[model samples]
Target: MTTTNAAEATTATAAARATGASAATDVLIVGAGPTGLTLACTLARAGAAVRIIDKSREFHRASRGKGLNQRSREFFHDLGVEAEAAASGIEHITLRKYRDGVAIADTVTFADRTPTPGMPYASGLIMPQWRTEEILRDKLAEYGVAPEPGCELAGFTQSADGVVATLADGRRIEAAYLVGCDGGHSPVRKALGVGFEGSTDAEECMVVGDVRVDGLDPAYWHQWFDEDAAVLLCPFRGSAHWQLQGIPERDADGRPAAPTLESFQRLVDRCSRDAGIRLSDPTWFSIYRINVRMADRFRVGRVFLAGDAAHVHSIAGGLGMNTGIQDAFNLGWKLAHVVLGRAAPGLLDTYEEERLPVAAWTLNLTDERLRAVVEGVKEAGVGTEAVITDDVTTLGVGYGWSSLAWGGAKAGGRAPDAPCRNGRLFDVFAGPHFTLLGFGRGSAAALAEAGEKCAGLLRTHLIEDGDDPGGHARRAYGVEGDGLVLVRPDNHIALSAGADRGAEVVDRLLRLGR
Candidate 1:
């Protein structure tokens, strides 16, 4: 991290030497975590010039955020990394509870469900955050763009036309837009003077880290809980390591103890006296205090915020990282469209309009879940399973009320996957283009005309009602009769209408984008 005074001096010097050359890229993204990396890959795949930077000297290797929900699985599939991510992950394991070294009960965190044609990934997968980041980084590398490590965003100024950003080492970067995917303490958000309003619970804190432990079964997530303390050890996929989480003892001054090997051992000893678990090879550690916060606004002029920069919440439901990934997915195509002049600049406003409410809702949901866990532990001697429900999977999130949503059936919802003639509905919606789906034979002409009108911007598919006996796509999309559905680049339903109004709906959506 650079000193504030040094950063200010560098920014001043860089601004004083501004030149008339065109910006180096269309978008400059700070923080190379999942959010920034996903956005970079999305934009670069769409032929937008993007540069991603991070202040960290090296890539993180910890199991920071381990739970990938169903919605995130669909996102990875669209990004073409689903196979790799699933290969590197394990299904959510059964959680085994122990009290005083005596096995009490076992339960699955996420309920099992059969995969439907309309929902390919019906369950969540557990992969370390490091693995997810590696996959996204590899995807970005395919576009010849890698995050510049150790490059700090010292300061930046956004004008009506572009943004001038100064790095800690005095390198000046010019971009048409800047995005702060940096974590909770985002430099870009600070520079933009965005208000982050929330409360941090100093009384609630936990120690989290990765370590190699012996004498513990790797099949199930082992958890030991008592009245005042708790310890959980879950095997991290793709490695001989376990992610350890526990309530740390407080110091003499009543502050939460610092996360160290000794503190972790003490926690284990207190929670599991006779489990015989021997912890060693400490890889990473952090004392995490619960913070619930959201940025007052996600955009400021030509600069914007995503991921933890825009909102942060309790990790009770594993919403932090997944929400950030969704934020990047939502922003990527919009940014690309505006940069390529395929859409009006106002299209960027929809990023915040669609995402901010989702963030707010997630914050409240996690807070409620956190309260449930705390209360359940206090009253019932264990956390309730209610914390991990279908809502945690994030499959129900959508933009139903946004201005971009139109039509009568399933409009403004996530476009579900279903078996198509060639592959699946997702396969048709893949890539950086919109999709127009005609649900029955009567809508063929409308689909063809819309495809011709939107040429490179859209791809059209016609699935007759008799094509599949199950009628999965029609049922999933709520198409009662011959209807047309337009899916946005982010795989959300933009418009759905009867066969007669299909072309009109397409024209109105294109005009809005224009």
Candidate 2:
């Protein structure tokens, strides 16, 4: 508040930087949401120093972006928070639809499928966005890194060597890289002068809030559909609050009403058409308009954009938050590699090349799903179920067109999880190391060569018939004989080739780091 205090703080920061105890980090994360937290956990797991900061002084208790797709669950598993997230979230949530206040249809939000040896997380989880962030934050704390609250990125400048970021408090932090995980109206993206081109539907708006309700069953996600309006009340896992979403009546100015408790209560009363059901104790609320947009570039020099800073999707398929989380997952390893000098800086270019198309596809997919929901509501009083296709799970997403993908179609796709005598293929692929699976006894020589040559950079496993008694690993990889599959740190297949070409594939894997 005074000049003396500001001078003392600056002096203290300088002394700390000189003593290597300052805000300077290997990576400076400019947001503390799920995306930023996921990135922090990822880089920290690899022993890269990270400092995550958020502008907000207090953590949010709102129920925003309240679901995780199957692919996201896999990342959570990789981050070592699967058990905690599972304990706090529910999977296979059922949607109970109603017409004119009478129950009409009951459907599960996910496609009915059995978990196989190759795909253990076949279903998505229903958890509040706040809890997801909490889980990630808790995991990040294990690395002795916690988000700095009330610290905001005022601006930043990057040279060829590193980035110097200035905070709102007149503190300067130097880091090898800076990431923008701030949401839709990202200051980082805006400061970079990057173009965010997309469309926003002003007419299509939903009132979302967390509230305590009476006389409603907490088992199913209750949806009430009318001729022109709809409402959905979903009970959050491990919390007394139910996330309420409703299409509210617009005003003469063609804008939805404010997201106040009274307005939400009115919406529930009108759309639900239930006299017994009542809303009370509203904690958080917001009016969400459909905004589908993507930044022109994910990277500008050493500064990078990720998560909502790079892309924003409609909430139709519940992909907005998950996409951001995955964006962090995709960029985390690349940033760590470059910062740790394990890879060339050029490897960072693949981030945009691989993720831009995915964001474009996501925007298009959510738009279609939103349209389908609108049409389904008009035709059959249904919408949520229309968005539950397998495509929304993001398991089918890949980077086959990426420059890093070698070999055939299997390369660049997510490496399937398979049962092994020890544990699972994922266990072998875990951590911040490349994985080389040499299938069959014939490839043992190649595995040994890779293990000796690559050492700490790669982990080689010779998966023989005895190691996979059930033959799931071979079947999952489509390898009938000796073959080699190289998996990247992000669990994407880098190369899949026959045993005879294993030596060549190993050489190619070695070149990726350089």
Candidate 3:
């Protein structure tokens, strides 16, 4: 309060600047999985001084989650790594679900649509977590930020202005915001002492392995369900290995004891019935129990939580990692603005309000899926409801409770997909940034104005391909003739109205982004 105290504070600030670049980071993210890495890239691209740390020494070898949804695929496209991933090991397709001895649920196929809006990508693909991480790491590296592995968070104090985290080695970082992408057993979550409310399925155990299977259909992910056992098989195109998920028991000592081919054989025989083929030595294997749960809240003052730190759920929809990715998408831009003084702290509240219910619904739906599979209820057809809810793949997700008010044409529910010309070829969603789609003459001129006004913050696309306007696209965006739609950084519709309200659209999008 006195001159002496002010001078002391100034000196401390100056000294901090001298050591480690002395920056109170705009965002400090913990964990380096797909979610954290994606957040790092997105935040760094937004020009925020971001720091990311993880407790793991290296990327893990085990295969955890595998399904990459259509929405996520589109997101990867925006990041410019989808093609690389497609070349690596990921197959662009969905799965077929079966039960007992019959194919009850045939997989629904999704085709590639235009770059207009809805999800801005095609149908989902099946890929391993390891490869997914590899793509994300490459993207982050492109942005000149790498994950600080082997660095763990010990504790933190959240003041009104910032979060201070003490590292495992006794270093502290004062960050404007801290988002925990750490897994289920997050040290940050424990520090907050918030309860993770849900039940663990202890009665039924699960066995998973990546094995080399010869002469099996590599095109589709196969599932078999019997009264006694269930088996899930997915092909790994890179190594010619099949990632297997089954029900297996553990030893009395609580050790894995589940690496043998015998356990896998039983599941195969019970479900497949046709024992013409055999499953031999595995490349990887493990056994464990799973739970369906979520955290009560996703925030605590300056310390916020995302990904597994915020919620954990059954992988029925392969949503664990995907949900975490969505958390990062929602939180990244808001953090950028808050640190840059463009938005108030209240903007962060929407993270929990938007994602918590989604997590809860996901957990509940996944549990229902497991129960249906175990109880032989899929035969009745009511069980498939649990399979995919809200397309939590991030496509069906929307910013329903947005804080911005661009009345004439603000963001609505889900964005739609439409075709656009990229000069080279047809383009899909104008993603990785806010995209504006316009119709009618002079639409492109208006979009050009909006683009220049917020060039770095938003991307504008003028679709002049057809005369009738995009059918499904028009309905999804609620635009009729001459109109404009504003998509957010994450590809959700921020504002969807006619191009006549172009000025209002630009104002709302820029302010909301701030």
The TM-score measured for candidate 3 stands at 0.81
Write the candidate numbers in order of decreasing lDDT.
2, 1, 3
Clashes of 1: 0
Return the TM-score for each candidate structure.
0.94, 0.94, 0.81
Better of 2 and 3 by lDDT: 2
lDDT score for residue 122 of model 1: 66
Question: 1 or 3: which has the higher TM-score?
Answer: 1
TM-score of 1: 0.94
Listed per model in order, the count of residue pairs whose N, CA or C atoms clash below 3 Å is 0, 0, 15
lDDT of 1 by residue, 395-427 (tens): 989999988887665777889999878689898
Tens digit of per-residue lDDT, candidate 3, span 380-438? 53332345544545565665666542343436355555433532111434334566778
lDDT of 2 by residue, 231-289 (tens): 89999777999999998767788677688877777777776674578889999978888
Clashing pairs in 1: none
lDDT of each: 0.84, 0.84, 0.67
